[model samples]
Target: MASTEAIAAAFRIDPQILEKWLEGKQPVLAKYASAHQQIFAQFEYIGGEWHPKLDRQSSVAMLDEPSQSQNAVESDRVQHPNSSEVDLEPQSTAMFQAVGIVTGAVHLDWETHKHSAIINGSTYPLFYISQKRKAFEALKAEVAATGNSRQRLIVYPRVIHFPNKQRAHEIAFQLVGFDKGQQTKQEVSRELLDFEFKLAGLWQFIPVCRIPCISIFRNFSSERLDYIKQAEPAKKVKFLKASHLPLLWKDAPCKPFRFNPKAEGDQGHPTFVTLKVKFLPERNVFSFVEQLTPVQETAPPFLKASKKDKASLRRQ
Candidate 1:
């Protein structure tokens, strides 16, 4: 059989919707199609001051690969810039508190833009990936250079979900902060989707400061991701083979399954990775302080005396 992507591309259908159809779960594919359309539109071209793109691996070819096992990698314990990119405005004071690596197999999820930043004699603002899917086929097999050998060893694959209408609405309200009915909503929705997709492209490849316990689940399919979301009310899960949803709180992180690029035939399916998750501090957004001062009574003495007399009279 043709790969799911190939088949979907041939028919001009979203690959995610096609995955469910292949699985014989065909009732509500329309909802997913709606979301996929809105989200995919913004990914075409993210013109920005700084963008993340793939740079060649910095490591000079060694006769033998580094003898770094999983344990050694952990013991070395490098903190990645540990990214979950947010286009922060002049918000409050915040610093990406716990800076380190996001463990498990990482995927460069979005396109990267380059700006001139140099650190330790190396270029700053390097390449990475993030939020949503890019063009149909190009995103899946793209290479991410994380100078870290640990991240390099893992598989990379296409793992993303379209922004649901609710997500779009939230982005519209929070980022755009205006609601002129449907038109503005749609515009903001596109903006949010584009922002995320652009972030995914950059962050996925760019290194971070914190080492998070996030593992990419191999061999998972979009259909399976939907099914996993259908847990009972107690679990508050409702995704699984239904549709793709964002990974909300890293604190209460959801282990959505994803395919590993290098994993063989069955590796494209999804499964949960058991990570020892530890909450990290907020990303630093500059610093802050506050000041207060006493105010003298500006009221006339007659008024003050009248108020006092009124209080005394009431007491009597």
Candidate 2:
């Protein structure tokens, strides 16, 4: 990601033209900017300056990792000719607010993804890695208690790149402004399913966070197969046996499950639990936020018990 000073030094272009080039929307030297995209990433224009699409971690590292001392970094800042002092610190992380729904939470160890929420119809992926887990827990509890899969959320979002996937920049949210009073609505349909299961309070390893956290997962294939085979016999469906839908608990005894990259198998038992899920495009995974009691299969109401069955029941 090219900085404003770097772009200026290399191109020697006017600030206004540079702003337009960063927009990448209207026609203004599109050929030149496109050709140079390899040299510069997609940038956003802010306060009449260029901001590169860099992840928060990388940006913070850039500020901290340099050998220069704080005084030296401060001295290197671009000084205004009229003013004696100029602070070189980059601007604060940009933020904006939106009313979104808490879709799902995703944590994948191999991908360096954790505490991330897929919100607003799965369009935004916001993550928080601070030591505080309360915000994330609050989100999970709200969804579970309300049973309304889509809870209206007031979110303050910022931009961040995937820590493992550097070139892929996306939106993130500051863990704040979770109002419990917000109304929620359930979006259950023929394709979606959900149900709950109690955790044994076991400890498990989460790869992304690099910590042993309490988490649990249940395979819903039996239920899924039953629904598919009975509801649509002609429709062909393939199951990815390795893809287990992990459950999110309201007041989970431990943190959510994390993927163990080195484990030979995903340790979990097969259960008849149904899950209400949403797909996270950023991580290419499904997150189950709400769970419901498994619906048992029953014979047709018109069917009557045979005399032999009644006799067997009497003997029992």
Candidate 3:
């Protein structure tokens, strides 16, 4: 008789196989009884269940020393005992198989959504929708034209927060481009699209924020005074020599960077500022605008008045 936890662990390893093993009558019961008599001795048959007691020291001893021969006996008791005991190989195989099944199921659902990309083998929840309406429309049309029966598209939105300035700068630099004057906004936008596509393949979406300058100081510089002096307006203000900056939306205008005075350390040490970012599904830019537009109210027929009244209304 095994403890409930052990039984549960066995079930988790392979439930169906265990079930099959438990079924089917065989004369092997006598061999099991003989080999594991100590195991049986520890348990008192209470009602329909076997309640284990401490009296079975020999059974406990067996547990402490697992023999390959004993495993054969255990295998007889449970289906796929060999699989359950074999190290990482079986577990990894099972996990990969499970992922494939899940991905297949997701592909069956929203395959119609064009421009939708699955990330992380359809595991992590993150996706990006194009900010353009035409892009979305094209995707929908393409999917419709293909007449594909299977769901192949799975997209998820992700929210990312930058805990420090350096990381945010790096991400922003990547999306917006680092070329001094060669990169135009359009070029930057295209680069963003490429970045989005690459990320979409691995994850649904990645929202990256600019790391706070203060955080960078806390992470790198040893002298708090040096950090403060460099940060002050009186001193030569320099962008911290870091790899990355925060990411902004493709169409959104770049805003001037500002630091929070309150965010400064209480002991005159510097701290990092945080930024928030969010990624969504890809669609056409026009469609996004249309979706965001508010409907206007039409005036009643009575509101349509004579020229004089209209003039008066205008004047009012």
- The best candidate by TM-score is 2
Better of 2 and 3 by lDDT: 2
Candidate 3 lDDT by residue in tens digits, 32-69: 45423543344433222234443333312232223554
Residue 272 of model 2: what lDDT? 27
Q: Give the Cα-based TM-score of candidate 2 against the true structure.
A: 0.23
Per-candidate Cα RMSD to the true structure, in Å, reads 25.1, 25.1, 29.2
Q: Which residue runs of candidate 1 sit more than 4 Å off their true CA positions?
A: 1-20, 24-122, 125-316
Q: TM-score per candidate, in order?
A: 0.18, 0.23, 0.18
Name the lDDT of candidate 1.
0.23
Q: Encode model 2's per-residue lDDT on 1-316: one tens digit a residue.
A: 2345656555555655555655765454665565356335544333333443334343223322233332212111111122111112223221111112333443312244334444433544444432223455676676677675453333333322222322333344434334433232322222232211122212333222222222221122233333333321111111110111222334433343344335565444212233333434445333445543332121111111223333343365
Candidate 3 ranges beyond 4 A from true positions: 1-116, 123-134, 146-157, 160-186, 189-316
What lDDT does candidate 1 reach at residue 121?
30
